[model samples]
Target: MGAEVLADKVYCYPFQKVVTGYLNKYPTPLEKNVTAVTTVEEQTDPATGIVYRRRIATCNNIIPSFLRKSREWIFKWSILKVTNIYLEEESWLDMKARVMNLKCRCLTWAQYASMNEESVYRESKHNSNWTEFSQKGTITITGAGYLNCILERFAQTFLKQGARKSIAIMEKILEEKYGSPVS
Candidate 1:
């Protein structure tokens, strides 16, 4: 078993603007951990016109130094020696429906653990000028035999923190691109 998180938030901007901001938010000073982002694949559904995109983000390793003290574990898993980690994101945008869905997961440490996240942005039910955003994340550590419990907790916290950071980045991007908040 692992930790799971769920959250809901409202972006003051309308769905269109919010989605635009979300897509453009990257390489910002506020989030230095993410070094670069590249779009690897893109396709458009001929019938529904939904746009699908796959992107990979290269990020500076965020693992705490204390975790590195596990020399034997690190030695055993030589893959952990790398300095940068990769995150894969797939997003589907339904232009007519005004919704965006995304799934992001870890690619660098998949052997040792699994961190998967799903998120969505849609027109707010109450206000057309606002967007509703929700996300869920789950983290499970498989390689860390006994310390799995503690490591899972740490990873869960990290996952939530990453989500919060993205929200902040989106807010800033919206403000800069579209000016003042709608409401």
Candidate 2:
């Protein structure tokens, strides 16, 4: 089984400012689960003037109590690794990320559970002063033998709940930093 999520939001801030905020959003109170962020690579394409960045962020495990013990045994931690491509000329940013269990070299369950997400940000067509952000993601659970179906359902539920909370908190942060949309 597979699950997908789509979210769209308009920010009053200009595209540049919105991009800045997104790059600096990790340390905010809304994302306390994130423990650290490290930039692994960065470069600019001379031909197209596009920028590429790769980052790895570590997050504390926040799984359900029932899964905590198993999670701890199979995975030492959770890490999100992402690559972002920015096209300033087009005022667009694209991101692809993978959420994985750290230290899972010899693990079975950990290999079956993973999360992949992709997102895009663009200057609003309605107004250049506003930015539009959209995200689409999928969560998958497989290779768990007989428990695959149950695990997939659990992952879907967990991700849905987390996404709702995170979006609410992120909106509040954006409002505080850029002020509410002039609507």
Candidate 3:
């Protein structure tokens, strides 16, 4: 019914540079599945000095090929019938704290299945010049018979690949912006 995915990484760059790279690396060719990203809401809290952003990322439908043929099952469950999948994301940035946190949730198949992801980037405890990144996600699938387990496994595998791709993109972004690796 559910599965958890966790990932961690360390970037040999300052927190600011790492966070900047993450913010700018999205919607790139590495994430071809992602079609578009739109900011829905943005605000700066004067009291806390935290910047908040809400974005919606539209992605190509990646439903398992096996499920693609089960049109009746999909239609009966009233899942996402469209070709595009939408993911809602919210991010909080604390410049003074040199930290950023992001949360993402799937919107297209919320009823039948859900994928929620959370990520954090902050100055490393050991070195201010380095950034530590941690990410975790939970995938829950319901309404499907035996396929729920299959879908969960597929989601876990897909998410691992996504993490690797994102890291590569982040590295490319940082190198392009900062000339070379910091450490």
TM-score of each: 0.94, 0.71, 0.93
Regions of candidate 2 where Cα sits further than 4 Å from its true position: 70-110
lDDT of 2 at 12: 72
CA error at residue 151 for candidate 3, angstroms: 0.7
- Name the regions of candidate 3 deviating beyond 4 angstroms: 74-81
Model 3 lDDT tens row, 1-183: 698889898888999888777776768876789888898999999999999999999999887665666467644754645689999999999999989999999998788888999999999998888899999999998877777898899899988888887887887788778877666
TM-score: which is higher, 1 or 3? 1
Q: Which candidate is the best by TM-score?
A: 1
Q: How far is candidate 2 from the true structure (C-alpha RMSD, Å)?
A: 8.3
Model 1: how far residue 122 lies from native, Å: 0.3
Error of 3 at 133 (Å): 0.5
Tell me which residue pairs clash in candidate 3: none
In order of lDDT, best first, we have 1, 3, 2
Model 2 clashing-pair count: 0
lDDT of 2 by residue, 80-177 (tens): 12122111111223322211111101012345565665666677778877777666656666554555566567766766775676567666767888
Backbone clash count, each prediction separately: 0, 0, 0
Which 10-residue window of candidate 1 scores lowest in summed lDDT?
Answer: 73-82
Sliding window of 10 residues with minimal summed lDDT for model 2? 98-107
Give candidate 1 misplaced runs (Cα > 4 Å).
73-75
